[model samples]
Target chain A: MNKFTEDDLKKELETKEYEYGFYTDIEADKFPIGLNEDVVIAISRKKNEPEWMTEWRLEAFKVWKEMKEPEWANVRYEKPKFQEISYYSAPIQKPKLDSLDQVDPELLKTFEKLGISIDEQKRLSNVAVDIVIDSVSVATTFKKTLNEKGIIFCPISEAIQEHPELVRKHLGTIVPTTDNFYAALNSAVFSDGSFCYIPKGVTCPMELSTYFRINEGGTGQFERTLVIADEGSFVSYLEGCTAPARDENQLHAAVVELIALDNAEIKYSTVQNWFPGDKEGKGGVFNFVTKRGLCEKNAKISWTQVETGSAVTWKYPSCVLKGDNSVGEFYSIAVTNNFQQADTGTKMIHLGKNTKSTIISKGVSAGKSQNSYRGLVQIGPRAHNARNFSQCDSLLMGDQCGAHTFPYIEVKNKSAQIEHEATTSKIGEDQLFYCNQRGIDTEKAIALIVNGFSKEVLNKLPMEFAVEAQKLLEISLEGSVG
Target chain B: MLQVKNLHASINDKEILKGINLEIKAGEVHAIMGPNGSGKSTLSAVIAGKEEYEVTEGSVLLNNEDLEDFAPEERAHKGIFLSFQYPIEIPGVTVTNFIKTAINSTRKAKGLEDLPAKEMLKLIREKADLLEIDRKFLSRSLNEGFSGGEKKRNEIFQMAMLEPKLAILDETDSGLDIDALKVVANGVNKLKSKDNAVLVITHYQRLLDYIVPDFVHVLHNGKIVKSGGKELALELEEKGYDWLK
Candidate 1:
């Protein structure tokens, strides 16, 4: 204590304070905190889902009841009390109007903050948006254009209603309902998420994005996102998430499954900016998500993510190479600052002969935050000639922060080839001095270095989301570096 | 425009520069020649405000202001530039973006307005031509996959862009052919003006043939042992640093 100065105490206090800690005010319907069979039935019935869908939900609930929470992720937190969370929270019913003004004002305001409101763009050019507020889809834009191209882009609820066969065929095929704890929960209680289906031999004309905003407190968001690209089809989807600043930690358990058939390609990206808890680690989001993709013969699937928010993050967007000559790629940049802890990466399972996968991950930690990259590449016994390359790099700014990399590679086939490289180093004073001598201040210099570090992953993101991600990265590392 | 009075600097508890005194007026080109263990680079690094080097004693004045209190970036805004001996390779960041950001940042620090994209593009193109740097190099990441000569040229291009009041070339001629050295020298000469100063730090005087210096000083054992006119560099080139030792 004698050696500790006032500056040290102030620094400790500053590390605990959360920058984005302002809550959004709204009133709406919310279910009692907790999960049970009745709650599952209530969620399905409230959405007016078909009887078979309701039965499916019940079956998943039954399976979920028999399973235990997964303990494999390198994240530890107070397990969210599932029974104390409200899975259903929506605005008052309104007419299904065709224009933006017909939507609820609260939902509109949320989208406004997200920078993707329909009112912001009179004629949406290449961007199509689906707004998911709380546990339900509020609205989707550019419906006519997607319909013209014979591409189905809508909410999963709507997909269940209009394209039930497509949903039934592909849903849970890649990631089963009981694959993991969060996935199992999402399987039984997911409220709403975006769904896209590209017809065979057709290339989607524009990028599709889903913006998710968690508005209600003490409510867990279980979003189920599914994408299906048929033979010779191509589609790119962007998913972004945010929650109003609050003191009560919220739970977000999402399940996303992507399937690319022969000669089809799919690119899925996420810019996760969930509200991490304030200093003292109070009131943030515990984000546990299961995102996986399946590439059929000659198919390609790529996943890119920029994860910055969340008090604790546990996710690994993965791929299953099932078809011969299929390709899988993952590029990710995860930044954690100020009492934030994130353990994220991807898994690539090569099952078809001659399949390949590549992964590049960059992690940055500052301000008492802990960031890690946990990835796995598995080559199946039958997958001869399988190939994989992985690179994981970590950048540390201050002594208080920690950066880690853990990669697991398993090769069963004698002909398979796998290579992995990882390095962890601090942003040396020399590097900072170099930038500073160029007239960039300490803060701006750190941002430049970080952006340069994540450029590969950021470049894979959609233009709109990439810009937002860049801004988020800058804000997250504000006064922590240099 | 630069003054160091009995400046003492050290790294890791070991003193590298001891009781060094130097002065440079505007429009003067000063060359510091030294052997491997000499502190020529240490002087440039300390003046550039590298954090690794601690100024244990004495003071540095740039145009009559206390230089110790300024940050590295503030010193840069005061028109000080160091052409790194080995340019860092920043992957994935284009040279255009890096230089533009650096230029605009300096401008902003000086309370100047931001440069428009079109204006910056035009300016960069003009400077690239002046330095004989290929336009494609501007689009690539800074020093990424560049050859030895290309890296040196890139450093010169950056020096041309910054147009600093004091330019410190730390061994800028160490890894260049005769032709490349001439091109770099030409670039430096074009950037020279009556209001700015240039400090050439190198062990070899080969670079002096291209950009003749106004003064040459011999640094040995962390101190300047000899000083003379331009002919001094030619003399050192002929006799080698062994004579100074």
Candidate 2:
């Protein structure tokens, strides 16, 4: 193990190539590289949206124009120039394909490289995948199979066209057009994302997923995802993202809203692996996302995320418990290395009697990165006997990294119970030596320790995705300690 | 099996082990008894290749090979084991998994394939039975919330599983009730073999009665001042270290 010194670890960590960094060379119909009311209107026109929808976009644009970029997050980077980003870009030759054979071979090859071959996935797993490239969702697999179970799974664009009443009823009910700065921008220029609806008293028979890829160089991916679970229904939705390597930063601002009616349940999971730039922070993605869920009486919602990429990440997946005896949970593991920055957590709002929420967050930072967990828990005046338990733990590797925790708890009802625990610790030398003396090398020791530290949250993930997230954690922290 | 020649070590400019010389052959048990802060633990740590203790002079050799350039893991792979006085608490890794990783890593270092799951389980059960460990105990996180006796016994359980060429027991008898001490001693005695050796470092002669040492050495200050047969431990117990000073 002498050869595996600190310097060697540093070199190995810096040199491990990002596996999903290759770009597909295909002609794309992209908007001009700028943002304005005309650009937003052009996006709406390209989608052939209804006049009401176009008016909604115009209203969101007006609000976004007056909003200032939020600076309170514990991250530092050059503010992205919104005007220099192309808001809409899609593969030029998008023919309506009925089978896998009719899909563009180049596009199919790109998904194959990402290890989600549509053909293979159809035969192997029951997961229905919606493949979104740049600003448009191109293909949705297992739609016929899902339609049999009375579950609506398709791209949000098609949902607007086919189920216009549902889309219009629930479009901005949870996250309004004026929710936040990035959310307003996403509402104005959002092109395409996944939409899922599980009917009352019917549990979806399979997992639903969306894979987002940023294929175009200068385009920003503004995706809007909405999932609605009716009374007594249950559905699990997964989201994943990756991008090609570039020397200039790319922008990605997304909005995700979930609605769980009486006795319904919704599980939302994400494994984000965007490009994290170079060792010197040359180029990567600026990910600013808004995700929130609403749970009605006797309903439940859970948010599980494994964030291992992005140059700068600012996200908070929140839940609003509005009905009596409702439940909400958030389990997350965020890792940042080599000039990466992440400020993420969750918010739990208890509004009714006997509501409950649990928050477990783990952050790992290495190689001059900064990771922070900022959370909020608010109990309303009428929320009698509401309960909340929050635990935030941070692990640091190398002296150059940083970890911070900011938790805000507000209890209005005297009977409400809230417990919060936060701990910050580094990988101790004694622990490393103990592993070393047991014949385990330092690199494997670090991985084992990290995996152990994150097991609680990883256990919350579904089986297949849990394995993938575990591997992602290992790869992200490879050769980070000696 | 192990030899330390004129070992001189220091930490932070303060000398600990001053010209310490010791040797132990296979099939023998040696006890090093000392008062508090008399450099007994320092010698065990230095021999185990801890980096904090700077060796100012002399050398430690295992099977006639110098261990100066070896890292702690390399030394462990070369068949040296030190049962820590206060075992580390790894909160999530179970005892069984920890031992499996240790065994497989050592095998990998020797260019061998991993032991099959069946064989690993069988070995763990056999060794665990010898130590009288509960099946449920083996599934708990390593040393987290463990009693002092359980920590010591767990260390011996690891030693029994690894079956190293040399095992150094550093204050293993501390914090154990009479029954726990007897069980731990019995476990160590059962594991002793003609091809391996044991070096026990303790402050009192209470543990020497159970796993009686063939030789006893008294360490005062930073040097060994007396060496004799097992009866020497009895004499030292009868008259405290004040006379030795």
| Top model number, lDDT | 2
**Local distance difference test scores for all models:** 0.85, 0.90
Supply DockQ values for each candidate: 0.40, 0.48
TM-score against truth, every candidate: 0.92, 0.94
Instruction: Mark the 10 consecutive residues where model 1 chain A has the least summed lDDT.
Output: A1-10
Residue A390 shift from truth in candidate 2, angstroms: 1.3
lDDT of 2 by residue, A1-482 (tens): 11122222333345478877898987899989888989989999998899889999999999999999999999999999888888899897654667777778888889988878987777877788888887677787888888888899988888888888999999989999999999999999999998889999989988898899899998889999999999999999889888888878988999999999999999999999899887887899999999999999999999999999899999999999999999999999999998999999999999989999999999999998999999999999999999999999999999999999989998889999999999888888888888988888887788778878888998888776776676677667765664
Q: Which stretches of candidate 1 lie over 4 Å from their true place?
A: A1-21, A93-95, A121-125, B12-15, B237-245
| lDDT accuracy of residue A181 in candidate 1 | 74
Off by over 4 Å in 2: A1-15, A105-109
The worst-scoring run of ten residues by lDDT in candidate 2 chain B lies at: B89-98
What does candidate 1's lDDT look like per residue over B21-66, in tens digits?
A: 8999999999999888899889999999988899999888999998
Give fnat of each prediction, in order. Answer: 0.68, 0.65
